[model samples]
Target chain A: MKKTVNQKAWFMVLPVLLLVAFSAVIPLMTVVNYSVQDTFGNNEFFWVGLEWFEEIIQSERMHDALIRQILFSSIILIIEIPLGIFIALHMPKKNSLWTSLCLVLIALPLLIPWNVVGTIWQIFSRIDIGLLGYSLDAIGVDYNYTQNAVDAWITIIIMDVWHWTSLVVLLCYAGLQSIPDAYYQAAKIDQASRWNTFRYIELPKMKGVLLIAILLRFMDSFMIYTEPFVVTGGGPGNATTFLSIDLVKMAIGQFDLGPAAAFSLIYFLVILLISWVFYTAMIHTDEENQS
Target chain B: MRISRSNWIMILYILFLMLPIYWLVNMSLKSNQEILDGFSLWPQAITFDNYMTIFTDSSWYMGYVNSIIYVVINTIISLTVALPAAYAFSRYRFMGDKHLFFWLLSNRMAPPAVFALPFFQLYSSVGLFDTHIAVALAHTLFNVPLAVWILEGFMRGVPKEIDETAYIDGYGFFRFFGKIFVPLIASGIGVTAFFCFMFSWVELLLSRTLTAVDAKSIAATMTRTVSASGVDWGVLAAAGVLTIIPGALVIYFVRNHIAKGFALGRV
Candidate 1:
C-alpha cells in the first residue's frame, strides 16, 4: 500500500539547500572558474584552458607535498584507528562519574584550537623552555622539533594523535555501547575467550563506526594546517609540510592563485576519492554482516 | 558481571587519560618563570596571571567573544536548516530526494582547503569578507551536514505511528511537529547542537582563512605570532589552556546524548 506523501516537507529542505548552495556550491563553482582561468590582478580572469593544472601536476613541489600528505594521513589512520579501538575497548561503561570523567579528559585536547595544540606542544617540547623538551634533555635524550626532521615528524604525529584520538574513541565507544548486552551474554554462554568475543562480536558491531573514524581522521589529517603550521611553521625546512600547508603558502603567502587553485582541487579529489573508498568499504562490511 | 583482571587494565587506562589534563592544569597555575624553570608535577608557586590575560587583554578576550558569537550563530542556523532537511529525508520520499541526501553527505566529505580561496573571493565580492558571518557561513558547509546526519538518526528512531496518530487527532503537519516531534527529539536537537558547536569551535582552517582582523579566532591569533620574533611560549600556553573551557562546559551537559548521536549517524 502506498502511503500519503506530504509534499510540505520540501519546505523544510529549502533553507538548508539555499544556505549550503550560497556558501558551499557557489564558492566551489568560483574555484572551478579560477581553476580553468588565468587572473591578471585587475579582478579579470581570462580562460587559460589546462595550463594551471598541467603546471601543478608537473611541478616537483606539488608532487613532494602530495607524497608528504599521503604519508602523514596514512600514518595517522594506522595509529588512530587501532589506538582508538583499544581505548574504546578499555574505557569504563558502568560507573557514571568515571564515565563522565573519562569523557571530559579525552575531550580536553579536542577543545583546544589546532594552533594552540601546536603551541602547547611547541612550548611543551622546547629544549630550553618546554617541559617535554627539557625533560628529554635532562634524561640525556636529544629532542628538537624545530631542528631535527624526524623529531618534527614525530612531534606533529603525536600532537595529532593527542588531539584527534578521542574523536575516534568516542565514536567507537558509542558503537560499542549500542550493541545489546544479549550479544555479550551469548558470547559468555558459548565460553568464548575475551579476544574471541571481541573478534567475532564487538568488532563486527564496530566496523561501520571504525570506517567512519578512519575516513574522518584521514581527511582531516591530510588537510591539517594550524597545528603543524604553528609547531614547525612547515619547517625545520619543508620537512613536515602537508598539502594544505603548501596550498596556503602558495595562495596566501606567495599569492600564487593559479597554482594554489589547481593544488586545492587535487587535494579535494584525493580526499573525495579516499572517503568514497572508505564509504564503499563500510557498505561492503554491512552487507557481510547481513549475510 | 564479575570483576576480573580487565578491571586493572581499565584503571591504567584512566590514569593515562588523566595525566595530560593534569599537566595542562598544572601549567596553567604556574608563573611563566616556573614553566620555563623546569618540568615539575606541581607549580612551585601558583598564579592567576595566565587567566588574567584573558580578562585584561581586549585583543585576547575578543577571540573568545568572536568565537562564541560565530559558533553560536552557526550552530543555531545549521540546526534550523537541518531540522527541516532531516525531517524531509526521514518522513517523505520525493523526486530527487535520494540525490539530495547523497549531495548533503558529499558536502561533508569535501575538504575545506579547496574552498578557502574561492570563499575568500566570493565573500570579498559580496562584501562579507573578514566578518563573523563569513566564518559562520563557511562553517555551515560541514555543520549542516553533521546536523542533518544526526537529526536524521533521531527522526528515524521516532515511530511513524506517532505522527499518524497525531494526524488522526486532527493535528496538522507543522502543529504535530511543533507539539509532538520537536519535544520527542529535544535531546537529539541538543546533542546535534553540541556536536555542531564542538566542530565549529575547534575548526581553524576555514575560520582562519575567512577572518584576519576585527574577528580573528584565538587559533588564528596564535598563528600570527609565528611570523614575528621569538614565540611567546608562556602566553601561548595560557591561551591554549583557556580555549578548553567552553567545550568542557558543553560536554559536561551533553556528553550523554552525543555518544548515541555519533554512533547512529557518522559512525
Candidate 2:
C-alpha cells in the first residue's frame, strides 16, 4: 500500500514530541550540562570542559562495571533465548482450560515488582530458612550467596533467569500463533522432518518478533538495577554490581555529581550506539525479506 | 497415550517458575517464628495475620492506592498521545518518519538510573514533585514509545481500505477512528495498555526517586520494611503477594489477546 505524502501528519505527531521533550530531552540536557561544568556549594558553578569525562573514561572501576554488565547481559540472553524457544515449542497449541491456566501461572513472576522479585529470592535462597537453600544444603552442595562471590553470581544469574525467561516465551508463543495452519499442512504434505520444518518455516516466520524479544531483553538486562541491588546489595564484594548499580553508588552514595553525569552520558551513548546498530540491521533484514 | 519429552521439559520448567513463588506464598501464610523455624514445602501452621496487617495498616494500604492512581494516569495519557502518532506512522509518509520512530525507541533504551537525579531536580524545580502526575509523566519517557510501537504494528495490520471507505462514506477522521478503527483494533489497544501498565507498575527507580511522601510507591514502601526491622520476613512476603495481584488481574483479562498473536498479524 502506497501512503500519501502529507505534511499534515506532523500535527498528529506533535503531542508525542512535546511530551517526550519534557520527560526525556530536557533531563538529558541537564545531564549534559552537568557533564561539562563543575559545581561548588551554594549553587556556584565553574567550567570543567571534558575533565570529568576523561576521568571516567580512564577510571578502572568504570571499566570493571562495564565488563561485568556485558557479561551478565550476555549470560542472560544466551540462557533465556534458547530456553524460551524450547518452552514455546512445547506449549499446548490450542486454547484450553489447561493452556490458559499454564499461561496465567507462568506469567505470575513478570507482574511482581522488581524489588519484590529481589526480596523473594533473597529469602528463598537463605540457607537457614529458605526452601532452595535448605534443599541444596540437604543435597550437600555447600551453597551460600552471602559469603561467596561465585555463589552470589550464580544466585543473581538464576534469579534473573527465573524472573525474565517468561517474557521470551510469551513473545515466541505469540510469534508461533501467527502462523496459519496452511503452512504446517503444506509441510506435512511434503513430509518435512520436524527439525527441517522448524528451521525453514517457523524460524523465518518468527524473525520479526524474535528480534523484538532479543532487543527488549538486552536493554532491560543491561540496565538491570533493583533486583540485584535488593538481593545482594552489590555484594559479596562488588561481584554483582553492574553499571547501573555502580552509577547509583557514585552519584547518590558518594554524591560525585560531575563524574556521575559524565558516566551517564557515556553509558547512554553505548546503549544508543548498540541499539542503533541493531535497529539498522533489523531494517536491512526487513528490506531483504521484502525484496 | 505416551508423554513426549518436550512435555516433560515444559512441566519441569513451570515447576521451576513456581518454586520461588510458592516459597513466598508459603512464607506469607506462616507465623514470623514459624517462617524462621525451618524450611517447609508448605506452611505448617497457616495464618492470615500477615495479610491482615497490610489491610488494616494505613501506610501499607495507602501505598497500593498511590501506585494504582499513577499507573492508571500513565496508561491513559500514553494511549491518548500515542494513538494519533501511531496512526500517522502507519498510514502516512511524512518527513523524517523513520528517523523519528527510531529516536523514540532509543528513549526506551535510556537507563532509568541515569535519569533518577535529573528527574528529581527537574520535577522539584517545577513543583511537580511528590505528586502522581509527576511519575506518570516521567514513565511516558519510556512507556509512550512502547505504546506507539505496539499500536503502530497493530494499526498497520489493518488495511487502508477501511480508512478510505469510512472517508468515502462521509465520516470525519476522528469519528471513523473512534467508532470503527478502534473497535477493529481493540485487541491491539488492550495489549498496548497491558504493556504500559506492566512497565509502569513494576518500575522502582524513577517512581521511587520522583516522589517522597505523598506519592510514594508500594515498591518504595516495601523497601522501608526491609530497613525497619532488619527482617520483617512474614510481612514482607505478604506484601510481595499483594503486589503480584494487580498484574495477575491485568494478565487474566488480556491473556487471550497476548496468546492470540500479539495483535501484529500483518508483520
Candidate 3:
C-alpha cells in the first residue's frame, strides 16, 4: 500500500505522542538526572559525572546478575522456540472443536496475572503440599526450590517454559494456518518426506511470526521480574536475581538511587539495542514479503 | 480409532499445560486444613469457604474491582489514541514517522523496573497516587505503544481505495471513520482491545508501585495473604483462580481472532 505525503497526519498522531511522552519521556529524564547526580539524605545533591556508571560497570554484583539474566534468557529461548514449533506442528490443523479447545487451554497461562502465575506455581510446587514437589519427594528425587539454587533455577526455568511456550505455539500455528493447502498438496504429490516438507514448505512461511515470537520472548525474559520475584523472591542467595530484580531492590529496597539509575540506563540501552536489531530484521523481512 | 504419535504428543503437552491450573483449582476448592494436611490429586473434601471469604471481604474483592477499573480505563485510552495514530502510520507518510513509531515501540520494550521509582514520584507529585486513574495512565507507557503497533498492522490491511472512496462519497473524516472505516476493521479493534486488556491485566510491577491502597490490584492484594500464621493457601488459591476467570472469559470471546492477535495483527 502506497502512503501519501501528509503533514496533517501529525494531528492524528499527537494524542499518542503526548500520552507516551508524559508516560515515558519525563520519567526517563528523571532517570538520566539521577544517573548523573549524587544526593545526601536531605536531597542535597552534587555532580557525580559518571562515577555511578563506573561503579556499576566494575561491580561484581551487576556482572553476576547480568550473566544470570543472559543465561536465563538463552535457556528460555532455546526451550520455548523449538518446543513451541514442535507442539504447533502436532496441533490439529483444521478449525475443529479440538483446535479451539487447544488454543483456549494453551492461552490459559498467558492470561493469568503474572503474580498469580507465580502463586499457582508456588502452590503447585511446594514440597509440603504441592503435587509436583510432593510427588518428586515421594519418588526419591531431591527437589526444593526454596532451599537449593539449582532447584530454584530449574523451577523458574520450567515455570517460564510452561507459562510462555504457548505463545510460540500460537504464533507458529497462525503462521502455519496462513500457508495455503496447495503447498502441502504439492509436497504430497512430490512424495517429499515429512522432514523435507517441514523444511521446505513450513519453515519459510513461519519466518515472520517466528521473528516476532523470538523478539517478544527475548525481551520479556530479559526483563523478567514478577514471576521469579513471586516464586523465589530472587532468593536462594541471589541465584535467581536477574537485572530487573536487582534494579528494583537497589532503587526501592535500598534507595541507592544513583547506581540504580545508572544500572537502569544501561539495562534500557541493552534492550533497546537488541530490540532495534530484531525490529530492523523484521521490517526487512516484511519488505521482502511485499516485493 | 487408534491414536497417532502426534495425538499422543498433543495430549501430553496439553496435560502439562493443564496440570498446574488443575492444582490451583483443586486447592481453591479444598479447605485450608485439607490443603495443608496432605496432597491430593483432587480435593477429598470440597469446600467453598475460600471463595466465600473473598466474596464477603471488601478488601479482598475490591482488588478485582480496582484491577478491572484500571484495565478498562487503560484500554479505552490506548485505543482512542492508537486508532488515529495507526491510521496515520498506515495511510500516510509524515515527518519523523518511522522514528516516532520505533520510539513508541522502544517504550514497550523498556523495563518497568527502570520506570518504577520515577513513576511513583511523578504520580505522587501530581497527587494521583493510589487512584485507579494513576495506574491506568501509568500503564499507557507500554500499552499505548502496543496498541498502536497492533492497530497499525490491522489498518494496513485496509485498502487505500476505501479512504478515497469515502472521500468521494462525501463523508467527512470523523464521519467516515465512525461509520465506514471502523465497522470495516471491527475485528481488528476487538483483537487490539483484547491485547490491551490482557497486557494491562497481567502487569504487576507498575500497578503495584503506583497504587498502594484503595486501588490495589488483586495481584498486589494476593501478597497480603501471607500473614504471621503463614500463607492462607486456600484463599490465595481462590483469588488466583478468580484472576484467571476474567482472562478466560476474554479469551473465549476472542478465541477466533486470538491467533492473529498473538501475532500482534500482522498475521
Candidate 4:
C-alpha cells in the first residue's frame, strides 16, 4: 500500500498528541524534576543533581529487584508463549458455537480486574482454605506461598500464566484463522507431516502476530505489580518484589521520592531500550521475509 | 464414536481455564462459614446473601458504578482521539511519522507504577483529585496509544482507492469518514473499544492513585474487604464475580467480531 506524503495529516494527529501530552508528558517531566532534587517535608526542596541516581545505581535492593524482575519476565515468556501457541493450535478453527464458547472461556481471566485475579488465586491457593493448597497438602506436598519463597515465586508465575496466556492464544488463533484452507490442502497433497505443515505454513504466517504477542507479554510482565502486590505484598522477605513493587514501596510506602523517581527513570529506560531492540529486530526479519 | 485426541486436549485446556473462575463462583454462592470450614466441590448451602449485601451497600455498589463510568469515558475519549490519528497514519506518510508512532507506543509500554505518584500530584494540583474523569483521563495515557495502534492496523487494510473514489463523488472528508469509512471498519472500532475498555477496566495502580473515595474503582474498593478481623471471603468473592459480569457481557456481544477484529487489527 503506497501512502501519499501529506503534511496536512498532522492535523489529524493533533488531538491524540495533546491528550497524551496532558496525561503522559507533564507527569513524566515531574518525575524528571523529582529525580534530580532532594526534598524534605512541607514541599521544601534542594538541588541534588544526580545524587539520587548515583545512590539508586549503587543500591543492593535495586540490583536484587532488577535481577528478580528480569528472571520473572523470562520465566513468563518461556511458559506462556509455547503454551499459548499449543492451545491456539487445538482451538476449534471452524466458526461454530464451540469456537465462541472456547474464546469466551479463554478470555475470561483477561477481563477480570488485576487485583481480583490476585485475590482469586490468593483464595484458591491458601493452605487453610484454597483448593490447590488443601489438595496439595492432602497429597503430602509442602506448599505455602505466604511462608516459602520458592512457593511464592511458583504461585506468582502460575497466576500470571493463568491470567495472560489467553492473550497469546487469541493472537495466535487470529493468525491461524487468517491462513487459507488452500495452504493446508496443498500440504496434504504434498503428504506433509503435521510438524512440517506447522513449521513451513503456520509459523511463517504467524510471525507478525507472534512478534506482537511477545512484545506485549514482555512489557506487561516487566511492569507487573497489582496481582503480586495483592497476593504476596512482595513479601516472604521481598522474594517476589519485582521492580514496580519495589519502586512503589520506596516511593509511596517510604516517601523516598527522589530515589524512587530515579529508580522509575532507570526502569522505564530498561523497558525502552529492550523494546526498541525487539521492535527493530522483528521489523527487520519481517522485511527480510517479504523480500 | 470416540472424541479425537485434539478434542480431548481442547476440553482439558478449557477446563484448566475455567477451574479458577468456577471456584470463584462456587465461593460466591457459599457462606463464609461454609468456605472456611473446608474445600467442597460445590457450595453445600448455596446462598445469595453475599450478592444481596453488595446490592444493598452503597460503598460496595458505588465502586462498580464509578468503575463503569470511568471505563466508558476513557473508551470514548480514546476512540475519539485515536480514529483520526489512525486514519492519518494508515493513509499518509508525514514528517517524523515513524518516530511519532514509536513514541506513542512507548507510552503503552510505560509502567503504571512509575506514573502513580506523579499522577497523584498532577491530579491533586489540578483539583481533579478523587474524580471519575481523573482516572478516565489518566487511563488515556495507555489506552489511547493502543487504540491508535489497533485502529491503524484495521484502517490500513482499506484500499486507497476508496478515499479517492469518495472524494471524486463529492463527499467531504468528515462526511466521507462518518458515512462510509467508519462503517467499513466498524468491527475494528468495536475491537479497539473493547481493548481500551479492558485495559482501563482492569488497571488498578493508576486508577487507585488518581482517585481516593468519590471515584474509587471496584478493584481498589475490593482491597478494603480485607479488614483486621478477617477478609469477608464470601462478599469479596461475590464482588469479584460481579466485576466479571460486564466483561463477560461485552465479550458475548462482540464474540463474532473479535476474531475478525484481531485478524485485521494490530493487537
Assess each model's interface with DockQ, reporting 2 decimals per model.
0.56, 0.73, 0.87, 0.77
lDDT of each: 0.80, 0.90, 0.94, 0.91
Looking at candidate 1, what is the lDDT of residue A105? 70
- TM-score of chain A by itself in each prediction: 0.93, 0.97, 0.98, 0.97
By lDDT, is 3 or 4 better?
3
Model 2 Cα displacement at A69 (Å)?
0.5
Candidate that beats the other on DockQ, 1 or 3, i.e. the better one: 3
Residue-by-residue lDDT tens digits, candidate 4, B1-87: 888787798899888878888888999999999998877889988999999999999998999999999999999999999999999
Question: Which residue runs does candidate 4 get wrong by more than 4 Å?
Answer: A285-291, B263-267
lDDT of 2 by residue, A27-99 (tens): 9999999899887778888999999999999999999999999999999999999988888898888889868
Task: Estimate the TM-score of every prediction.
Answer: 0.93, 0.97, 0.99, 0.98
lDDT (10s digit) by residue, model 4, range A129-208: 78888899999999999999999999999999999999998989988988999999999999999999999999988888
> Considering TM-score, where higher is better, how would the candidates rank from best to worst?
3, 4, 2, 1
* Candidate 2 backbone collisions, by pair: none
Q: What is the lDDT of residue A135 in candidate 1?
A: 83
Q: What's the residue-level lDDT of B72 in candidate 1?
A: 93
Winner by TM-score = 3
Clashing pairs for model 3 are none
Candidate 3: CAPRI quality band: high
User: Highest lDDT: which candidate?
Assistant: 3
TM-score of chain B of each: 0.92, 0.96, 0.97, 0.97
